[model samples]
Target: MSIVVNLQSKAKPETTTKLISFIEEKLPAVRGFSGCMQVSICLNRDSGDLLFYEKWSSKEAHEKYLLNIQNNGVMAQLMSYLSDPPTVNYYESLDI
Candidate 1:
Protein backbone atom coordinates (compact mmCIF):
# COMPACT_ATOMS: atom_id res chain seq x y z
CA MET A 1 0.00 0.00 0.00
CA SER A 2 1.14 3.51 -0.68
CA ILE A 3 1.77 5.65 2.39
CA VAL A 4 0.39 9.16 2.47
CA VAL A 5 1.66 11.65 5.01
CA ASN A 6 -0.52 14.74 5.27
CA LEU A 7 1.02 17.60 7.23
CA GLN A 8 -1.03 20.62 8.30
CA SER A 9 0.95 23.62 9.43
CA LYS A 10 -0.44 26.33 11.65
CA ALA A 11 2.05 28.96 10.66
CA LYS A 12 1.19 32.64 10.79
CA PRO A 13 -0.15 34.30 7.63
CA GLU A 14 2.86 36.51 7.02
CA THR A 15 5.23 33.59 7.31
CA THR A 16 3.25 31.18 5.13
CA THR A 17 4.81 32.15 1.85
CA LYS A 18 8.37 31.81 3.03
CA LEU A 19 7.47 28.61 4.85
CA ILE A 20 6.07 27.10 1.68
CA SER A 21 9.07 28.20 -0.31
CA PHE A 22 11.39 26.62 2.21
CA ILE A 23 9.56 23.33 1.96
CA GLU A 24 9.40 23.52 -1.82
CA GLU A 25 13.14 23.90 -1.99
CA LYS A 26 13.65 20.97 0.34
CA LEU A 27 11.05 18.77 -1.34
CA PRO A 28 13.03 18.30 -4.52
CA ALA A 29 15.76 16.54 -2.60
CA VAL A 30 13.21 14.29 -0.90
CA ARG A 31 11.32 13.58 -4.11
CA GLY A 32 14.54 12.38 -5.64
CA PHE A 33 14.69 9.57 -3.10
CA SER A 34 14.01 5.99 -4.18
CA GLY A 35 10.56 5.39 -2.74
CA CYS A 36 8.97 8.78 -3.18
CA MET A 37 5.80 8.53 -5.23
CA GLN A 38 4.55 12.10 -5.27
CA VAL A 39 4.62 15.36 -3.34
CA SER A 40 2.18 18.26 -3.35
CA ILE A 41 1.74 21.54 -1.47
CA CYS A 42 -1.64 23.16 -1.06
CA LEU A 43 -3.31 26.07 0.66
CA ASN A 44 -6.70 25.78 2.25
CA ARG A 45 -8.98 28.40 0.80
CA ASP A 46 -11.24 28.54 3.81
CA SER A 47 -8.71 28.76 6.61
CA GLY A 48 -5.58 29.87 4.81
CA ASP A 49 -3.82 26.80 6.06
CA LEU A 50 -0.91 24.96 4.44
CA LEU A 51 -0.80 21.29 3.68
CA PHE A 52 1.95 19.00 2.49
CA TYR A 53 1.10 15.69 0.90
CA GLU A 54 3.80 13.08 0.60
CA LYS A 55 3.25 9.73 -0.98
CA TRP A 56 5.72 6.89 -0.63
CA SER A 57 5.91 3.35 -1.99
CA SER A 58 5.56 1.77 1.44
CA LYS A 59 5.47 2.39 5.17
CA GLU A 60 9.05 1.23 5.54
CA ALA A 61 10.13 3.74 2.93
CA HIS A 62 8.42 6.57 4.80
CA GLU A 63 9.72 5.39 8.15
CA LYS A 64 13.24 5.21 6.85
CA TYR A 65 12.97 8.73 5.54
CA LEU A 66 11.68 9.96 8.90
CA LEU A 67 14.51 8.23 10.72
CA ASN A 68 17.12 9.72 8.45
CA ILE A 69 15.57 13.17 8.88
CA GLN A 70 15.80 12.95 12.66
CA ASN A 71 19.34 11.63 12.60
CA ASN A 72 20.44 14.42 10.29
CA GLY A 73 18.51 17.10 12.25
CA VAL A 74 16.70 18.13 9.08
CA MET A 75 13.34 17.88 10.85
CA ALA A 76 14.50 20.23 13.57
CA GLN A 77 14.92 23.11 11.17
CA LEU A 78 11.21 22.94 10.36
CA MET A 79 10.28 23.87 13.92
CA SER A 80 10.74 27.61 13.40
CA TYR A 81 7.61 27.94 11.28
CA LEU A 82 5.34 25.70 13.25
CA SER A 83 2.72 27.09 15.60
CA ASP A 84 2.34 23.62 16.99
CA PRO A 85 3.52 20.13 16.22
CA PRO A 86 2.43 19.42 12.66
CA THR A 87 -0.67 17.31 12.37
CA VAL A 88 0.31 14.16 10.49
CA ASN A 89 -2.09 11.64 9.08
CA TYR A 90 -1.13 8.34 7.49
CA TYR A 91 -3.40 6.86 4.90
CA GLU A 92 -3.63 4.22 2.19
CA SER A 93 -4.76 5.00 -1.33
CA LEU A 94 -8.21 3.55 -1.79
CA ASP A 95 -8.79 4.53 -5.40
CA ILE A 96 -5.70 6.14 -6.82
Candidate 2:
Protein backbone atom coordinates (compact mmCIF):
# COMPACT_ATOMS: atom_id res chain seq x y z
CA MET A 1 0.00 0.00 0.00
CA SER A 2 1.09 3.53 -0.67
CA ILE A 3 2.20 5.56 2.33
CA VAL A 4 2.13 9.22 3.22
CA VAL A 5 4.68 11.01 5.41
CA ASN A 6 4.22 14.34 7.01
CA LEU A 7 7.34 16.11 8.30
CA GLN A 8 6.87 19.20 10.35
CA SER A 9 9.71 21.39 11.58
CA LYS A 10 9.75 24.53 13.64
CA ALA A 11 12.38 26.99 12.49
CA LYS A 12 13.82 30.07 14.05
CA PRO A 13 12.00 33.05 12.56
CA GLU A 14 15.23 34.42 11.15
CA THR A 15 16.08 31.19 9.43
CA THR A 16 12.69 30.37 7.98
CA THR A 17 13.25 31.85 4.56
CA LYS A 18 16.64 30.22 4.12
CA LEU A 19 15.25 26.92 5.30
CA ILE A 20 12.42 27.07 2.76
CA SER A 21 14.85 27.96 0.02
CA PHE A 22 17.12 25.07 0.93
CA ILE A 23 14.22 22.63 0.81
CA GLU A 24 12.95 24.05 -2.46
CA GLU A 25 16.36 23.63 -3.99
CA LYS A 26 16.48 20.01 -2.90
CA LEU A 27 12.90 19.12 -3.85
CA PRO A 28 13.62 18.08 -7.41
CA ALA A 29 16.02 15.38 -6.23
CA VAL A 30 13.40 14.24 -3.71
CA ARG A 31 10.73 14.09 -6.39
CA GLY A 32 12.99 12.06 -8.63
CA PHE A 33 13.75 9.46 -6.00
CA SER A 34 12.51 5.97 -6.73
CA GLY A 35 9.09 5.21 -5.19
CA CYS A 36 8.35 8.82 -4.52
CA MET A 37 4.95 9.57 -6.02
CA GLN A 38 4.53 13.19 -4.96
CA VAL A 39 5.98 15.88 -2.74
CA SER A 40 4.68 19.21 -1.51
CA ILE A 41 5.73 21.85 1.00
CA CYS A 42 3.78 24.13 3.25
CA LEU A 43 4.97 27.01 5.38
CA ASN A 44 3.20 28.73 8.24
CA ARG A 45 4.85 32.11 8.36
CA ASP A 46 3.06 33.17 11.51
CA SER A 47 4.27 30.13 13.35
CA GLY A 48 7.54 29.42 11.52
CA ASP A 49 6.48 25.92 10.79
CA LEU A 50 7.66 24.12 7.65
CA LEU A 51 5.75 21.07 6.53
CA PHE A 52 6.64 18.42 4.01
CA TYR A 53 3.97 16.17 2.53
CA GLU A 54 5.28 13.17 0.66
CA LYS A 55 3.70 10.10 -0.85
CA TRP A 56 5.60 6.94 -1.59
CA SER A 57 4.83 3.63 -3.25
CA SER A 58 5.20 1.77 0.05
CA LYS A 59 6.35 2.04 3.63
CA GLU A 60 9.50 0.16 2.75
CA ALA A 61 10.24 2.60 -0.01
CA HIS A 62 9.84 5.49 2.38
CA GLU A 63 12.11 3.78 4.87
CA LYS A 64 14.73 3.35 2.17
CA TYR A 65 14.55 7.03 1.41
CA LEU A 66 14.97 7.81 5.08
CA LEU A 67 18.08 5.69 5.15
CA ASN A 68 19.45 7.38 2.06
CA ILE A 69 18.86 10.80 3.55
CA GLN A 70 20.58 9.86 6.77
CA ASN A 71 23.51 8.35 4.94
CA ASN A 72 23.87 11.41 2.77
CA GLY A 73 23.70 13.82 5.72
CA VAL A 74 20.61 15.46 4.24
CA MET A 75 18.75 15.00 7.49
CA ALA A 76 21.52 16.71 9.40
CA GLN A 77 21.56 19.58 6.96
CA LEU A 78 17.83 20.04 7.38
CA MET A 79 18.07 19.87 11.15
CA SER A 80 20.61 22.66 11.19
CA TYR A 81 17.88 25.04 10.09
CA LEU A 82 15.37 23.99 12.71
CA SER A 83 15.02 25.32 16.20
CA ASP A 84 13.90 21.90 17.49
CA PRO A 85 13.59 18.36 16.30
CA PRO A 86 11.18 17.70 13.46
CA THR A 87 7.97 15.73 13.87
CA VAL A 88 7.54 12.94 11.38
CA ASN A 89 4.33 10.97 10.98
CA TYR A 90 3.31 8.21 8.61
CA TYR A 91 -0.12 7.19 7.39
CA GLU A 92 -1.71 4.65 5.13
CA SER A 93 -4.36 6.04 2.84
CA LEU A 94 -7.96 5.05 3.47
CA ASP A 95 -10.21 4.80 0.48
CA ILE A 96 -13.60 6.33 0.91
Candidate 3:
Protein backbone atom coordinates (compact mmCIF):
# COMPACT_ATOMS: atom_id res chain seq x y z
CA MET A 1 0.00 0.00 0.00
CA SER A 2 1.08 3.55 -0.58
CA ILE A 3 2.14 5.47 2.51
CA VAL A 4 2.02 8.99 3.73
CA VAL A 5 4.92 10.33 5.73
CA ASN A 6 5.22 13.28 8.02
CA LEU A 7 8.50 14.73 9.17
CA GLN A 8 8.60 17.41 11.80
CA SER A 9 11.64 19.47 12.62
CA LYS A 10 12.36 22.59 14.61
CA ALA A 11 14.78 24.76 12.66
CA LYS A 12 17.43 26.83 14.38
CA PRO A 13 16.07 30.35 14.30
CA GLU A 14 19.25 31.74 12.82
CA THR A 15 19.41 29.03 10.19
CA THR A 16 15.79 29.13 9.12
CA THR A 17 16.52 31.04 5.96
CA LYS A 18 19.35 28.74 5.01
CA LEU A 19 17.14 25.76 5.70
CA ILE A 20 14.45 27.06 3.39
CA SER A 21 16.92 27.83 0.66
CA PHE A 22 18.44 24.39 0.95
CA ILE A 23 15.06 22.75 0.62
CA GLU A 24 14.16 24.90 -2.34
CA GLU A 25 17.31 23.78 -4.09
CA LYS A 26 16.88 20.13 -3.18
CA LEU A 27 13.13 19.74 -3.61
CA PRO A 28 13.34 18.89 -7.26
CA ALA A 29 15.53 15.92 -6.44
CA VAL A 30 13.10 14.85 -3.77
CA ARG A 31 10.11 15.15 -6.02
CA GLY A 32 11.83 13.17 -8.73
CA PHE A 33 13.06 10.46 -6.40
CA SER A 34 11.77 6.97 -7.07
CA GLY A 35 8.42 6.16 -5.47
CA CYS A 36 7.77 9.73 -4.38
CA MET A 37 4.28 10.81 -5.40
CA GLN A 38 3.97 14.21 -3.78
CA VAL A 39 5.61 16.52 -1.29
CA SER A 40 4.43 19.51 0.70
CA ILE A 41 5.93 21.58 3.47
CA CYS A 42 4.48 23.97 5.98
CA LEU A 43 6.06 26.04 8.72
CA ASN A 44 4.93 27.16 12.13
CA ARG A 45 6.55 30.57 12.37
CA ASP A 46 6.02 30.86 16.09
CA SER A 47 7.85 27.63 16.90
CA GLY A 48 10.15 27.49 13.91
CA ASP A 49 8.92 24.02 13.23
CA LEU A 50 8.68 22.64 9.70
CA LEU A 51 6.18 19.99 8.73
CA PHE A 52 6.91 17.90 5.67
CA TYR A 53 4.10 15.86 4.20
CA GLU A 54 4.89 13.29 1.59
CA LYS A 55 3.23 10.47 -0.26
CA TRP A 56 5.15 7.46 -1.43
CA SER A 57 4.51 4.23 -3.29
CA SER A 58 5.39 2.22 -0.23
CA LYS A 59 7.12 2.28 3.15
CA GLU A 60 10.10 0.52 1.66
CA ALA A 61 10.36 3.14 -1.03
CA HIS A 62 10.55 5.86 1.56
CA GLU A 63 13.11 3.95 3.59
CA LYS A 64 15.16 3.37 0.48
CA TYR A 65 15.16 7.07 -0.30
CA LEU A 66 16.29 7.81 3.22
CA LEU A 67 19.19 5.42 2.85
CA ASN A 68 20.23 7.01 -0.44
CA ILE A 69 20.28 10.51 1.03
CA GLN A 70 22.01 9.31 4.18
CA ASN A 71 24.88 7.90 2.15
CA ASN A 72 25.11 11.02 -0.02
CA GLY A 73 25.27 13.43 2.96
CA VAL A 74 21.91 15.10 2.38
CA MET A 75 20.71 13.78 5.71
CA ALA A 76 23.68 15.31 7.48
CA GLN A 77 23.14 18.63 5.77
CA LEU A 78 19.50 18.58 6.83
CA MET A 79 20.43 17.91 10.44
CA SER A 80 22.65 20.97 10.51
CA TYR A 81 19.62 23.16 9.86
CA LEU A 82 17.57 21.78 12.71
CA SER A 83 17.58 22.67 16.38
CA ASP A 84 16.37 19.17 17.19
CA PRO A 85 16.50 15.89 15.31
CA PRO A 86 13.52 15.48 13.03
CA THR A 87 10.66 13.12 13.88
CA VAL A 88 9.09 10.99 11.16
CA ASN A 89 5.95 8.91 11.06
CA TYR A 90 4.17 6.97 8.35
CA TYR A 91 0.59 6.01 7.68
CA GLU A 92 -1.45 4.27 5.00
CA SER A 93 -4.59 5.63 3.46
CA LEU A 94 -7.89 4.24 4.69
CA ASP A 95 -10.25 3.00 2.10
CA ILE A 96 -13.65 4.59 2.23
Compute the lDDT of residue 48 as modeled in candidate 3: 99
Which segments of candidate 3 are over 4 A away from where they belong?
none
Q: Which ten residues in a row have the lowest lDDT in candidate 2?
A: 87-96
Best to worst by TM-score, what's the order? 3, 2, 1
TM-score per candidate:
0.81, 0.92, 0.97
Best by lDDT: 3
Candidate 1 lDDT trough over 10 residues, lowest sum:
43-52
Give the best candidate by TM-score. 3
Task: Summarize candidate 1's per-residue lDDT along 27-81 as a digit string, tens digits.
Answer: 8878987799998888764565778899999878888887888888778876666
Give the per-residue lDDT digits (tens) of candidate 3, residues 1-96.
788999998999998889999999999999999999999999887899899999999999999999999999999999999999999999996666
Q: Model 1: residues >4 Å from true position, as ranges?
A: 45-48
lDDT (C-alpha, whole model) for all candidates: 0.79, 0.89, 0.94
Backbone clash total, candidate 3: 0
